[model samples]
Target chain A: MLERALNGGKLYWTWIGFLLAVFGVGFLFYLQQWNVGLGITGMSRDVSWGFYISQFTFLVGIAASGVMVVLPFYLHDYKAFGRITILGEFLAIPAVIMCVTFIVVDLGQPYRAMNVIFHPSPSSILFYDTIVLNGYLLLNLLVGWTCLHAEKKSIAPPKWVKPFIILSIIWAPSIHTVTAFIYAGIPGKHFWLTAVMAARFLASAFASGPALLLILALIVRKFSKFDPGSEAIQTLGKIVTYCMILNVFLLGLELFTAFYSGIPGHMHAWEYLYAGIDGKGVLVPLMWLSAILAAVSISMLVFPQVRKNETLLAIACVCVFFSLWIDKGFGLVVGGFVPNSFEQVTEYWPTLAEFSIAMGVWALGFLILTVLYKVAVSIKEESGGEAIH
Target chain B: MKIERREFLKLAGLSAIFGLGGTAIAASVQQTPSYIPDPKELTGKRWALVINMDKFKTDADVKRVIEVCHTKHNVPNIPNPKQEVKWIFTEMMENVFPEQQDKYLTEHYKHMPFLTLCNHCANPPCVRVCPTQATFKRKSDGIVMMDMHRCIGCRFCMAGCPYGARSLNWIDPRPYLDPKKINPEFPTRMKGVVEKCTLCYELIAVGKIPACAEASNGAIVFGDLEDPKSEVRKVLAETYTIRRKPELGTRPSVYYVIGGMKDAGKGA
Candidate 1:
């Protein structure tokens, strides 16, 4: 089954080559960062976390979103999702890898990262996050691989795998929730101090995760014989629609609480993100662009006519993916740091080396995703163009 | 390849015992001896600092205190404000105590420079959020202590602290330190560790006080809050003092005596 990924068309090999080139460039910059320290990045004492952490947050959501397909098929017995559930699980494997990589690159002492495990602090949310994320990754790998391997043999998946599938279903939300707790539990960070943080994270994750899955499914359908079924794609589109709506609504609630209450601590971060604070608002234009994209994508997704059109749906997914990327990945993390502990604004923008390192991590993830998806799709195509359940 | 039930049971039992015994040996090997306090150490139930803002009469007075602490600690002198790392520094009264600031506040109160350092909170969020026990509060005297070697430099503590006390060594700090001025007694931090004021724990171990407190010319007082007769307690008893962001429930050990001066002058 693994050998299937090794044998690919020229286009596939070219794509792989492109990703490798990008990864190589990024690795060089990462080496520079390793030598110089985090001072190579734009992060400061005022804004301690920057691009790397934000990417980690976003990718965690992507990993958790695998539950969307897994839950419907395994728990609710939604037959349509059975075709694409493996896709979701395989996507999660690479997403989790990327999340861990982003965190490692962001660390000032990447070698000492195992200290979290060696000297475990249950009091810290980061400790719990480490446990859940690695657990979720293992769960997805086991469930997806076992089921897919069983399918290749044209037999029912092992009965023992069912309990693991159920566990993965429950474990998915815990990963994102623990990640949210990392920020929400911090005392002085008013922007992330809201109780709704976990809920908001889940909403955005569900939206962005399914949106990316929808886009990937479309791409897979175009390039491969595996259809993934139109019904499955439409169902995912619906999931993205509802989740994006909830995500926007939760964001609106946050805005209302910040503005209506008129709390300086709460409102200051919002002001810094959307409007210039003391004439230093680098993220203002990007934030507004995210807002416009969200509104446009949500409106387009709600209409059945637009969603039924594959071209229109792909555009909507792209919008949702990038919009949420900006909102959660860029805005949320940096906003919390902006109106810093002293109510002073200090802007953060990733340096070129930082961007290169991040891009390399993304390329590594995609490289993994391509190989996994190739194996999964080839197995499906071999089994008479329909996914074996 | 099949083994008899009796033989399988024996093998399993033997491996289990060896595994348990190996783990016990490893744990014993890893165990570190407990610390013994020096007899000459200045003992306290809860060490605290009270800054007499009135005593800081000149800009040079505040600079001298900051210089003494930074020099003693080997804190890097990074000129870039964005990447600057400081154990103790100064901020205006208005910025330091934003909750206390107002339009009607006098210029003397508004412009006064207040020394800022780690509060070493009684219920510190930094200690709570640390994934490893890199930063912890000393149980003996309630001083917040940082193990730079243990710190992974995740900067979670920086976000957890409300007073902006912690600083990450963003670059190699050895180059930033002057060779002649480098303190041999105190360890200079590496590029990838979070550090902050240790409240002069080293000095306290030798029956002295914090470097800043010693250099402040009576502006800073250090003592045990648990002791009723301590100078810090007497200062708190007499003067109207405030802690930064007390509403956050961190219960900072550091206090600032506000409006205690008979003759207030322009701040530097």
Candidate 2:
């Protein structure tokens, strides 16, 4: 039975080919990072965290958004979401995996990521985020797999899995909030120095992350046999639209407070992002592109017709995902570094070497997702083997 | 062939139903800690600092404190910008804030160095927020300090500091120090760790004044804030002093008396 389940789907050698190419490129970049240290990456004294960390920061939100969907389905017995629950769990696994990899790459000492466990700092939020992120990953993985094992045998998932789901349900936002606390707890980086920053972060995660997932749903619908309840997809899209609007509102509030009050410390980031300080002209087109994409995506999502149309929906989803990714990845990270305490506009762009290494980390994440998804899909397909090719 | 995704509907429903209850549990535990080892010893002293910015008259004086502090500590100065480290470095606010550079201060007193370092806030946020126990506030005193080897170079502390006081060494900081210019009094910092002024910990640990205090030749006052008879306490009592951004409510331990007009004007 297990062999029949596993052997149903084609091995997808094309995917394997793509994965290897990404991995090879990534490997070459990783070598550069290993030999030279972070110098090969664009980081400096004032803006310490750059490409690696920005990706980490953005992905943590994406990882946490898995729960935004998870909470509704498993814990509440939302029958509509039964088909999509595996995607959430598995997507979470990759998001969390990516999140972890980003931190490792960003660290001046990748090996020392473990010292958080060995030499624990109970006071630090990063310590707690580390703990919760790992625990959350294990919980989702264990719960998801336990169910998968039952699915494989055509049996009911054991009652023991309930506790893991419940723990994970509560644990998801904790991971994101702790991630936010890593920034919000700081007293003086004006842009980051807000109690609401965490709230804003989660809000953006809910909006942008779900948009990414819904977009993924459309892709799967196109390339795969998974229908994954369009009603559920539309419902999640509505949630993303609602959250995205709120996120934009909060961003407006942030800008008003900084610029209207005329606090240079607070306004410095705004200028760096929108206006381009010291004529760096660096974040100029990127920030505008992000804003326009965000607006169009939100608009597309607002209308039922556009949301239902797969091609259009995919376009909207891609735009929103890229928009938020650029905002978080480039805007926020580099923005914080600007008007650095020294008041110099130190610009950072990821070199080909850095970008390639980043691609490697991302490829590694995708590889894990691919394997996990393959196992999950095969088992699910066996339960209803008549539909898929 | 199928790209089957296990749709996470049930989990999504679960979180929405009880997300707040989870948040409430989190809310109860969310009271974060601060690095300021504020000894609750109910002392006659709430710790404070009194800086005579005027006493920083010459570049040599500013250089003296940095030199002594760097030497006393093993602060390496690697030449690359990534690794460049400093236990004490001069920051021209004009240099640091050139765009906001005003004519009032620049026109009046062209080259007055604020000689800034870690304000060591009574609310030292850096100590509590460092994940690997790398940065901490000394129990005996409120001076926030760092342990370099333990630092993972996460730089979260740098992000959290309200004062913009913390710095990260982006490269090998040890190679850049001018050997002859290297001050033998204090230690230097390494790359990757966040570091700032320790208020001359070893100096104060011994029966001596801080390097900055010594350089000022009685211009800058240093003594136990706890001691009623201490000179710092006396200065605190006598003068109407100011701190760098009291609005942030960081409760900076470093106090300042603005001899120059540019002093209080830097309200940011």
Clashing pairs in model 1, backbone N/Cα/C closer than 3 A: none
DockQ of 1: 0.70
In candidate 2, which residue ranges exceed 4 Å CA deviation? A1-11, A31-35, A260-264, A342-344, A385-389, B1-49, B78-83, B93-106, B109-111, B177-191, B238-240, B260-268
Candidate 1 lDDT tens digits, A1-389: 78999999999999999999989999999999899999999899999999999999999999999999999887888888888999999999999999999999989888999999988999998998899999998998899899899889878798999999999989999999999999998887899999999999999999999999999999999999888889999999999999999999999999999999998888989988999888899999999999999999999999999999989999999999999999999999999998777677889999999999999999999999999999999988877544444
TM-score of 2: 0.83
> Could you give candidate 2's per-residue lDDT for residues A1-389 as a string of tens digits?
23432343344656756887997898887766665667677776667778888888888888888877777777676766676777778888888988888888777666677878878888888888888888878987897778777777777778878777888888888887888777776655677777778788888888777887787666666655656667778777777878888878888889889989997788888888888877885888999999998899888888988887767766877887888888887787778767665666777778787788788888888877777776777666667511110
| CAPRI band for model 2 | acceptable
Which sections of candidate 1 miss by over 4 Å?
A: A385-389, B1-36, B264-268
- For residues B150-198, write the lDDT of model 2, one tens digit per residue: 8887887876675567667665555666776666565555545667777
- For model 1, state the Cα shift of residue A221 in Å: 0.4
